[model samples]
Target chain A: MRSWLRSEDSWAVLTGLLVLLLGLLSLAGVNALGWVPKANEWTTPLKAVSPASKAFALPGGVSVLLLYTSLLGFLCLGAWRMGHSVKRFAVGFTVLFAVGYGCWVLGHYAHLATTPNKMAEKGITWGLGLTSESGYLLALTAGLLVGNFFPKAGEWLRESARTEWYIKTAIVIIGGVYGFKAAEDVKLTQTVLVRGLAAIIEAYLIYWAVVYFLARKVFGFSREWAVPLASGISICGVSAAITTGAAVRARPVVPVMVSSLVVLFSVVELILLPFAAKLFLTDEPMVAAAWMGLAVKTDGAAFSSGAITAGLLTDDPAQQQAMGLTTSTVKVFIDLFIGVWAVVLAVVWAYGVDRKPGQGVPLKDIWGRFPKFVFGYVLAFAGLLALGLWLTDPVAKKAVKEGMEQADQLRRVFFVLTFFAIGMGANLRRLWAEGLGKLALVYAISLFGFVIWFGLLVSWLFFHGVKPPTVGGN
Target chain B: MPDDKRTAEELAKQQAEPLLPAEKWLIFGSISLGLALLGVLLWLTGAM
Candidate 1:
């Protein structure tokens, strides 16, 4: 027991668990007390006001600003500790935060409300209510930023036994929201199945082929760096890359570059995709949702895009929900492939670099290296789905649903905090010393390849003669 | 002899000299400028 506690990995895990708990607690407290800002309140800063009026607003405004202040404090601390490398991390974090914040703001402006009350009333939830969902997101962002500043503090926040329980519980709750029952409702045609599989395969192939060639020939990046970058960009973005990098024992700079590129491109895609869908697509929510899911690398980006598109294209509440669910479900499916892709990349790297038959790492070792928490995530999701389906009673379903929603919200909050912590740990000097030329080339190749494959396969399978499943419609 | 040669290689690798501070700054500045330009372009195109 003492030995287990002494392990560095164990400590990190413990820290993560605690942080997850804090996030959950904060989420529950914020939700219950209504600490989140309403849509209208978000716009308050932009409103014309006299000096006298502004004075009264200042107090409330200052509270709102606390979140940003905490984030800045965390950044400063991380910079101080991490030294020269801190700059790169700061840049990456800033890009990610800016994009995420922009999306939240845009989503609010678009009036994309998922709650039943707003849906039924067909009115926007307004004001700077501290209990609003957006407010919670803001708070989570702030918490993460603060966490990033002090690694020890961040670890402590994440590692408590309570946080571990909360994280697992949250994952279970999010499962219900994913609608596992709805999974069967959508008929899987040969076409749909083929398209999905094809998209996955093509995405992988394009990523590897393009990134490999560019990294080796154009950028002169070591194969070690190229493999992880390609895996990350082509699969689930930063998370996938980080996991694979750890598994293969790639240099730290490789993962950093991959993460930075992922953040940059993710933001670009988030802003670009919605507008593109609006302009080009036929205003079919499912089609738009599918497009967003297939094109965007991350679930959050896909969901935000889907929500915005749904708001613009449809007035039907059911349709909006369906779109949101579809985008999320698709992205989660893509996320599941991260482990498989990472393992495969690990094998390739081992054999290619070491040039030994049976001398490469055993499959068991690779399996051990894989991130295990992801399974907990999957289990939680699956559990929710089963519970949602088996429990026929409306009251019970509602209760379960609410529980899941709270948990899902908590998980997202913790994830944001984790990202903030990562940003704080980043170092710019190390990145610069390594030379960005190679990294940039790898990123460009991977991104370009992914976009091409995603666009082509999605269009060919779903858009061109084939019809995909709808939520309620046959 | 092999050990000596390996040590020489290690020494050479270590002695491969890092970029000058001025050169490093120039590279960083160029990258920042490029990113800024890209951001501006994105904004102008209403992609932001």
Candidate 2:
């Protein structure tokens, strides 16, 4: 309904859909989104900015200006519709975009981001070899410094710091990225999709039950507290915890407490798991990739972990693509189906557990609880896939190359912004706050003691032998 | 009692209660689903 526009999830979907549609117009020889800016690895700052599409050449300054104006217009429209002050949002957003994208450009400095393979070409004997995704980490660090050290700036930027919205939008764009690849190699795509499906099902059914048992019996938490905590730790973190709280009709404070812990632990996972995967599971690239999706709780953290893992594990572009694709496939499937799991819990609690005389669990609740942005992700993926299969002309090829590539660049920009927003949202001081001690202890125990290792085992079961397609497959 | 203290007492008291029949069913159902899914995955991957 028209009222849905107020939801950030709907706005993310709409924004992503608009980008996809504009990109698709290139199949008709229209280059509407070609002006979007992309930063490249560079020794000098001036060389960093360029149009995303190789087909269109524009002045670097013009490219950045065009991207800035376009993003502000689109996002400001959403803010206005959502009953936010467009003026304040625009002011905050401009500062965020400038600083966040500056961090992005800084992260791409040749000395910092040039991979080992390209070290010689960049005339650098030594480089961090973190790949360009270091931008994400830099952006996060920059935002955290502001959030903790400069509280006023952080508060001012709060109006535009929509972490989940940015990440969900990026995920929709990534769906197109994979969908375009799927068009080229249907068999490999089929394999990862099926594998990802299995991984998420196993994740939900096994991980949730185990965590719930531990929280209730081992940690001595009440059913009210344990349910949301289980959902948060074993499933997709904040969204899962919030939905499960609603399903079980628990106090709102229960989910809020659980969600804060989920955020804290997810940040921990984001920092540690990628390096762990690189060290232990690099030989099994797909396993490492799927492990990130399965283990990391938040979408931003999960996807960012995947990107960082790809950078750490190998310098090969093909292997990196493979890893990113596998992680996104698994995480997206998990995000897509959490609503059904919530519905199941609702029925079980209402009908079988409490059995309150007047209370009824309606099927319509699933619709209300469903994440609408997933629809955008599915639409983008399926639409791109259908187009890829249906069109085979030179113009279509150009569209696939230039348009999709530009869309990928836009997706990366969103990802960097998401990292910054996530960091800005996380208040490190809150972890030490009173009344969170029990929740934090339960999380630390359940997550590290069992959940993470179990996730790795499940990921290996599903994705062990699978390999991403070679570079030319793209 | 303060809200936090009351809530904590309630949680602790509930924790000592025996597992409800419905909770048992939920656990059983989840494990069954997990096993079935694992079986299907093994078959699909030719690992069975």
Candidate 3:
């Protein structure tokens, strides 16, 4: 078990389970005792107080900040003990503390500033929609400049950039949100689930085939470049690129390069997909929401785009709420496929592609290479789903919702950390030298020529005419 | 004399990078079809 905790996935799953357990317990105890925190309330604005840690506030009004900072410091210390330099850990922790909290505050304010309702109240009439794209864009840009122009600082920042762990943990927490949120309207969720499942299949089959062919035939890339590039273009870009890199046994640079492209293009899609979805698919709103999931690969970009698209296109508040829910359902459906997709690809690579003749691809290889944190995600999802099903009582149902509300808040904090970590690791100059110019061209052509249109068509075919209930209680 | 010769041979090998597998087409093609089927099953049962 001590050895097990060294792995990123194992730590993520254990932490996620701990979070889920604590949330359930704290909510249950509070309900039973009729006690509540003085300053405990859930809202998106910045107050230095968090829903999750508010119950345990200290004498100073700095409980959440202290807890959050300590959690990161411990993670840093863990990495240091695991065989990193003290200087690197020191530099990394400083940057992580500064950048993580900085991005959170900036994203919060950007969200408030760009919100359409707020802008409308000020008589501005036109503003960026509900999404928090501005802060992420700023973080990515600052990272790129630092990575290229000030390489020393970037190196320090990159010390704590455990992008995979951060993202994986958030994904595990997202599973709980699904179980809790999906219970509200079973019918709509089922539809989103089915359609999203079918759509991901089409996406994997059609999109991967076309982009891969283009990479090989058109761009003249070798299999390593083609496969990772295709994976980044076809499915959830960051994880897909990493998985393909490992499956193909490519160099470490290959995944990093591919991931850089994914991060850059995610920002592009963040700016473009929502406006396009609104322009075309307003009446078929759910389709637009699903298209956001299919087209944009990163979680922040996809959900932010969905929120913006939903806000811009729909005037009905209930419809907007439905759109938000449907958006998560579709995105999680696509995100969950990475685990299964990784296994299948590993088998194909080991057995069918790169193996020495007569050397069998052992099952153990696949299991070892497999992402174990995915089990935590699926288990959490299933547990919550079961919980939702069993909690037929009204009070029990309400408790589940409140508990998950805190979980989702923590998930967003993890996601914001993930964004900073991903950005810190990226260097545009390296990306360019590693064939970003060519890769960018291929990515653009693949995304615009096939990915976006195909996603739109399939989304429309499956999710068209599915309107959420307005002016009715679930 | 043998060590020098071995070093020269290793340097030559280091400079040459191998091309990707010839079986890539067959690999991705077959796997994509299989994944599609798996996806259909998942959708049919709403399992995932």
Candidate 4:
């Protein structure tokens, strides 16, 4: 039994199982506590406005569950023989965790009562409303930091077979949440067409043309590291950078630098963009939302910016909804393109880096490097949309809706977990080694470019006589 | 032992030189120009 368990394949299976189990148990615990209540009085009215009212419940449980498991996994990995430092882990986890908790606290208490029928019109509230999943996940991340510092307690929990089992279960269950079909259900119109096209173009140009030059030319980054660092800053932020780094076999330090810069810049954007909107474009909520959505690198920062913009424009419901929908939709559209962009970069890197007399990329290199799970994600979204369309029966539709909703909830949880893992993996020392000057330059250039492109698109689309309806007035 | 040595050699061989001093200034200039063009275009279009 000992020999069998000690085998490499056996260890892999064991670890996988541990991840899944932990995810499930944490999910169950979060749900049981009603820590994040499914039905809130505040969001009910907003639910009524939405075509899918039943799918209004916040997926906080999934978020918390993912957070806890991911943190646990990171701690476990850190505790292993790997050269993971406690101080580095603690620092990264603490900042991310605090941000998460702040979100949760804001969700639970902040009220959006300025508008009449405050419950139905799901405007941005300070404490908690529908999309507080991000907050709960953040809190879980904080808990991980606390747990990590207490090594004796962490060790006690780590020794247990049950704990291991739980973590593995959570990872597997997390996979079920990435429903491909839901992606198709997201309606695309003229607004989406323009935004989607802009996002894709901006992601590449900012990464290559702007951020790349800054990283290499200004900051004095080597080509090896500059590519991934710029890609991360310009594309979808940390995750995109990390994914691209892994695919291109970039130096570990590259991802660390990217993650640090991303986290720092994201926080800055969150604070600055809302103020910029209020000060500069107070009368133009749609333009403000569009600018925030396009300029901000991360979804969380964009959402935060949108929420602040909504708060500023509380007197106008139509404007508030438009702002909220536009920011969320644009961010989601950007998220959807992460896989495609990664693939394109992977192909580029193969030819550019791996093909020469001394270095030759394999034929199967791109396929091997590509993130296959994204295919599963796209497939699940497409499959569900097909089901939703083909099955005309109300009962069938209801079931599909429920399934998709659950999947979305699960997806949120996985994202939280992934972020937690990312935080765990992150270390400032690694980032310092990569140098800061280049990263700073890249981020500045990218932001500048994004602002201009996004602003142009908004002006072209809505500048002329497009009197967007004022809140509650139209 | 030979394989490990060969791998190390290959890794060392793959390392590219960091950006040159002139190259740095050129990149900086290009990025600045791009950003300026974008900003001007947006301003002209009444986006600001």
Candidate 5:
């Protein structure tokens, strides 16, 4: 119980809600989050940074400093409680934030990130047009260089490089954004949420069955190996693999091996799938969003893929936000099922597959396996949603949006950190040296030959013909 | 039937034993099917 209380998951929820609470102070007419830094597209360095809100008219560098200090303090508090070396973490996080945010500012250069619509005014004939979120890709690439080439730096930074916690915090902040959008158009937002739930359920059942069969019959893996592999590849990646591993009483090595592969492949999917979705599914934006949630494995990679795909597929900020919300909604629904599915697997393995005398299903493991950070996500979302619905005054509604805007900017900062952390944690040489030939082959075949296409089909079935509400239109 | 076919059938059934208790499969299948139906209904109503 003590260990669970101090776990990274619990800290992530607490940290995330603390940020949201500060932002929520806008309801009382104090924009506590307004000083958060935002990077804007610019031809020159001087024009690139600003306070997230016009109300806090601090100089750009000051805004960045405020952001850094607050994040360092908030994260260090968690590190201290979680039994990490707070001094080392603070130092490592400082360097990481500097380098990561530097790449983010570079990605905001006019020639690299300016969209087509703004190209004319910027006097550039063409730009990469990846949108401001290009910072995520830039941060990822820069971190990969540090990880693969600068082994000493990677080791030094390892104590603070927490990809999952960063992404979960970002997710909770995004839930607030979703709630604000919901207030704007309840019917549309609810539809996206409902479709996302249905799509994940339909896709998961088929995905698990097919992958399990393929691993068992085609790859000729044993049940112990196949069950966790299927769940890892078919469900929410590392968490699902670990939970299913415990459920089936597999050796720890089984889930650990599956987890490394999931991370590597999730990064690969993050890099590749967004472009493919943009190319093939651009017209059906919601389908593309759902596809990203289902096809990408890890939460960080999945949410990042959604943002990149949304950036590529549209110029409208409203549409891009909607795409991201749809993706998160689907992924969260999938996350909700990990505990339930763990129980199902436990029951089956205990009674049917490898039952031994005195071996009972570990039903209590379900609660242990539940993703704790999801509570923060749901709370932020529901709180903002209830406030949106209850507030009748237009003035109050505008303040709510203003507050959420600050939270959204902070979410982007966490996302950039997540991208860099994910890249740094991916050790290509280690994955290669581990003799993962059969398992890699199975993942390749199952993912490319079956899972991706099946996910696209399921997404299309549920989300076809649905479009997000255009700006100012419901 | 050929001897090989008979052997394969026996092997298949033996391998399938763990997945028995067809009731479990039935319940999961019904849930999935119901969700699919709900999706279609929602789509038809433009509520999903």
Candidate 6:
């Protein structure tokens, strides 16, 4: 318990919670702490001043971008101060922030390049539907390229490339965003929430177990590698891999390995799933939607796949709309699995698996093993939801929405930083090492062969007859 | 003496290692599935 609280994960969670709490409170006009980021004060929408100018047009000023980066950098500096000189840490953090910001800007440009309206202004068909997440991919790619080519620099810079810390904070912010979105449309959320609950159960009991067995029995992986790998493949990818690694007390390398595989595979699915859906599953589009929820691992990629799917097949607008909404809903709904599953894995590991051969673990050890960030995540999600529910006044709700949006900006920055750092942290050569070779093979067969089919089956099972809320539909 | 030392090291290593506690996780997995079901019920009834 002592180590658990003192652990960097705990500190990061506390940091994220306090940042979000203060920001939200400030929005509610309770900004007693003048230093805190006031609610709705984080960002402004893009200003469309000079109509023909080539600059960012979105809201939330660039100052917050700098503020969020510096604040997070110092928090990281505080987290790592024990390991490095203050001056060195500060300098390294500046470089890290500069690189991340550059990538974010480049990514923003890529988004603008793909926007339909922007492209139409140039007489180009903006077909890709790429969003700001393109920046995350660019960051990851750049980080990997740098890390692979310059091992010496990779080693040195990795001192500040704290990927896990950044991601956990983003996830907590997402909890708030999710809560607000869920409350924004209770009917839609409820529908997705109910059906999505069933989809997750089928995923864990069937998808997770099957993949786990494939890793262990077929590929001959040890238990530690296989468990986290199973969760990574079966559940929500990178986040699930990290959570499972912690629950099982596996070394950090295990989750890192599994996470790399997930990122690579998710991209592949992101590209292939949409085209595959349009070509084959257009007839039974909900099946494609469910398949998307089952197949696409991360939020960004799943959403991109939905966008692509919607853009491509235009035969039935009603069906396409349903497919798009269902795909996003099911995927977002699956994002909720991390908190609950982490709780389950924690109890199992502390009490059941990690006990001594002839010895038993104390009940309190569960506290140590349970991922502390999950509490921050769940509390933020539930609190935001309840707040949205209770504060029915339009002005109050609008204020909450603005604050949550600002928090979301913070979350995206962290996510972008995390992907870059994960790329930096990964040793590409080791990815193809002997053990991982088999791991890769297992991922290939399972993702392509089993996941797609089973996703379609279960999605059909639960959502076949349950069509989208379309009017005068046959 | 060396033999005894090796045995102690092995024991410590075993004690330190992750024990692949799949069964306990199985029980927990069931609990998670149940909670997911509860989520569905609550959402349907507008209690969530």
* Model 6 lDDT per residue over A1-474, tens place: 545455656766766776578557746665322322211201122421111111323333445454556675666555553344555555555666667756765655522424454465434554453444456666767777778888887777766777656766766676676676666556655665566666667557667777876776666666677777888887778777776677666776777667777877776676677778778865666667777877777554555455456545443444444565566557655656655666666656566766546443332433444445656666777788888888868877766665665566566667667767766755666546543466678888888888878777666655655554443543
Candidate with more favorable, higher DockQ: 4 or 5 = 4
Q: Which TM-score does chain B of candidate 1 obtain?
A: 0.53
State the weakest 10-residue window (summed lDDT) of model 6 chain A.
A35-44
| Alpha-carbon deviation at A335 in model 3, angstroms | 4.9
- Over A1-474, each residue of candidate 4 has an lDDT whose tens digit, in order, gives 644443222333344333333323332332221222232323343321111123335454454444455555554453342334545545544444445434443343325232333534446434332233334335334435534465444333223212112222222232232222223233322343344444444455443556677655555566666766776666666556766676566766666556666765665565566667777776666667766766676544555566566656544544554565555545555556666655655555556545445443332543433333333323333444454456666655444444434433333333343334333322323334322444555566666655446543643454333334553344
- Per-residue accuracy of model 2 over A1-474 as CA lDDT, tens digit each: 778989888998988877877787887788888888889899877898888776668977888888889899999999999988899999998988898888888889998899888889988899888788788889988888888889889999999988888898888887787677677777777777878887667668888998898887777787888889999998888888878788888888887767877877887898899889878987788899999999999888999899888888877766776788888888888887788888889889898888998887754655665667878888888988887888788667767767877888888889888888878877787666555567688888888988789889888877887777667653
After superposing candidate 4, which stretches have Cα over 4 Å from the reference? A1-36, A39-106, A110-195, A243-249, A271-293, A298-355, A362-373, A394-438, A448-474, B1-48
TM-score of chain A of each: 0.59, 0.96, 0.80, 0.55, 0.97, 0.71
Question: Which has the higher DockQ value, candidate number 1 or candidate number 4?
Answer: 4
TM-score-based ranking: 2, 5, 3, 6, 1, 4
* Residues A1-474 of candidate 5: C-alpha lDDT, one tens digit per residue: 667657788877877887778888888999898899999998989989999889887999999998999999989988888898999999999988998888889889999999888999987898989888789999999778888899789989988898888999999889888877777778778778777766556545767867877777676676777877998898899888888888888876777777877888898899999999878997999899999998999889999999999988997878888898899888888888888788878877777776787888776665676677777788878888888889999988888788888888888889999999998988776445434556777887888888889788878877888897677764
C-alpha RMSD by candidate, in order: 13.5, 2.5, 6.5, 10.7, 6.1, 8.3
**Candidates' TM-scores?**
0.56, 0.94, 0.76, 0.53, 0.91, 0.68
TM-score of chain A of 3: 0.80
DockQ, model 4, C-alpha based? 0.10
Descending-lDDT candidate ranking: 2, 5, 3, 6, 4, 1
Higher-scoring candidate on DockQ, 2 or 3: 2
Off by over 4 Å in 6: A1-5, A26-65, A81-89, A110-112, A118-129, A221-225, A236-367, A456-474, B1-48
Please give, as one word, the docking class of candidate 2.
Answer: acceptable
Show pairs that collide, candidate 3.
Answer: none
Supply candidate 3's per-residue lDDT for A180.
Answer: 58
Q: Which structure among the candidates has the greatest DockQ?
A: 2
Q: Which DockQ values do the candidates obtain, in the order shown?
A: 0.02, 0.40, 0.11, 0.10, 0.06, 0.10
* CAPRI grade, predicted model 3: incorrect
- Could you tell me which residue pairs clash in candidate 5? A191-B48
